[model samples]
Target: MKRFSFIALAKLPIGLQWAVLAGGGGLAGYALHQTGLPAALLLGPLAVAICMGVAGTRIRVPRLMFRSGQGIVGLMVAKSVTLGVLLALSEDWYLMLLVTAITLLISAGVGLGLACFSSIPADASAWGTAPGAASAMIAMAEENGSDGRLVACMQYVRVVCVVMLGAWISHLFVGAGDTHLPPIAAELPFTWIGLGMSLAIAFLGALSGNLLPAGALLTTVILGSALQLTGWLDITLNGTLVTLAYGVIGSYIGLRFDRATVKHVARLIPVIVAANVVLILLCSALAWPLSYLFGKDFLSVFLATSPGGLDAMAIIAVETGSDASFVVALQTLRLIGVVLTGSFCAHLIMKWNARVSR
Candidate 1:
């Protein structure tokens, strides 16, 4: 009966498909939130969407909506990255750079190991495991004649693992206590005009950010951070709007997991998953020493170093009451490092794999 019901649900009209996602995702999110899990809004929708996707539902969140979600998240991150955060980040610039460089090396080593031992192709392996800026990695992979689809698959798979494990880690280290949503009306202090301006900025940022990979989010972050720092604008997003953004972003990724991609990569799934887990574990291990080095909570530093989606990690950082500013700064720095050095790293990994196999 359950299987039959799901089959029927899969064949629903596009509108009904959307309705199911919204309702199911919301209920799931609420249930998880009640359980005090951080990032319930994101993880719940992601899980539901993935099921809908694997079951072959024709559900697609519009591109603009996805970008808007990113924009909203970008602004959220911007609000967190204040002047004190800047000074702190600057003080530890060398450490951050060192960590990023080490992360890239570890990612490359993982890719090389995969290429040499696994059934996955070398090009795919090389690009799939790039540690930060997934969009940039995918684009760069394709530009360099790597398999873009597989690269995307590998990137998102790692992202899913990172988020799930990061959540669990947060639960263990920080304790998931009191996850109920704050009252929307009292969530933030903003005048009507401030809210209007915030939305305008998000909309415009998403509209104008298509020129680069993850540009909408990055652009919004830059714009919002500048305006907020200059005291020219105040961000005023309520809980409802932010939750909607989270739902859209999570749904966007979930809807992309069509049956075709899954079946095509089924044979490679084990190794891919193993690789992601290894990368995550290694990163988490680094977080411990770094936490002590930086005098921050383990969760804050862990979230900063976790090779997850920036938006997802940011949400977790905020929910757990960690140092969100530190998380954002380090993540932004690592993303920049990854984009700048992806090609050279890919080449090096590929070459090492070739030599080892020979």
Candidate 2:
């Protein structure tokens, strides 16, 4: 097989190169989807992009593409935010706070464990193991002068593991039968005006996110939820658009896992994997009591508490007839909490490391 070279790829127009990469990514995603893996669309494209990147293809996705992807995912999440879900959350506000705090502890503990066992820096491990938005964590790690590539690898690896494990648990333990809920966003009737308005909000949200922490995705999520909550707009994102968003986001993250990055984190791989498994199991155990207290099924509670990407967990929630709103709501709350406290927490980790070393 002829290997793709960066120099040869650079000779082509950037647009053409991107189009070719996108096509390849799509085909790879399709193949993976056929294999019945959870999050095949995302994992598939991501795997292919990583290989392409390692092979020296200089096809870089623009920042705008990822932001747009976030906007689309945010809009999809908004579909689950109904008045009933809001009321459920309001009634259980204290419990939500408690769960959020517990999740933070779990993340911090995992970060500390990784730092102690691996050669990665404490601050880097802290941000890397945070069960927050992958993009947000990576960006913060870079801003904090930590190794962004390593952080990205850790975050995404956890996501993939959490997703696959979540799916298995949903199927084996929860018995996620056929979805009973009506197709909220996926089946909604589409209108050009609605799409145009949604796009405008997404674009504005992306621009505003520049000034806010974890702003791009969270801002769009807030905007979309508010619009639906107030009955001011019915945001119906098309399936094709949502899939495109997933593909782009997956490709962007996947390309970061080039050969050099893999080599850099080689020794820490086993420790990272172990920590992820431990975190997932711990969170699931915590979910059991909460499930009884909340009068919800264990599966829904577990999905809500599981430390995975918001979009990935939400997808599992939808597919399994779990409480999509609850899952997304809890995940969103935790994401916000993580992003807000990420810096302070990282500082604490670094300080502790310094003191212990001394």
Q: Which stretches of candidate 2 lie over 4 Å from their true place?
A: 1-20, 32-38, 170-186, 354-358
Q: Considering summed lDDT, which 10 consecutive residues are worst modelled in model 1?
A: 178-187
lDDT of 2: 0.76
Candidate 1 lDDT over 159-272, as tens digits, reads 889889878887776666744343223556768998888888888878875676667777888889889999988888888888998899889888777777887787888899
- Please provide, for model 2 over 58-137, each residue's C-alpha lDDT reduced to its tens digit, 9 standing for 90 to 100: 67778777777767767766777778888887998899889999999888887877777678889888998788988789
Among all candidates shown, the one with the greatest TM-score: 1
Cα-based TM-score, every candidate? 0.94, 0.84
What overall lDDT goes with each candidate model? 0.83, 0.76
Q: What is the lDDT of residue 262 in candidate 2?
A: 76
- Model 1: clashing residue pairs? none
Candidate maximizing lDDT: 1
RMSD of model 1, in Å?
1.9
Model 2 alpha-carbon miss at residue 54, Å: 3.2
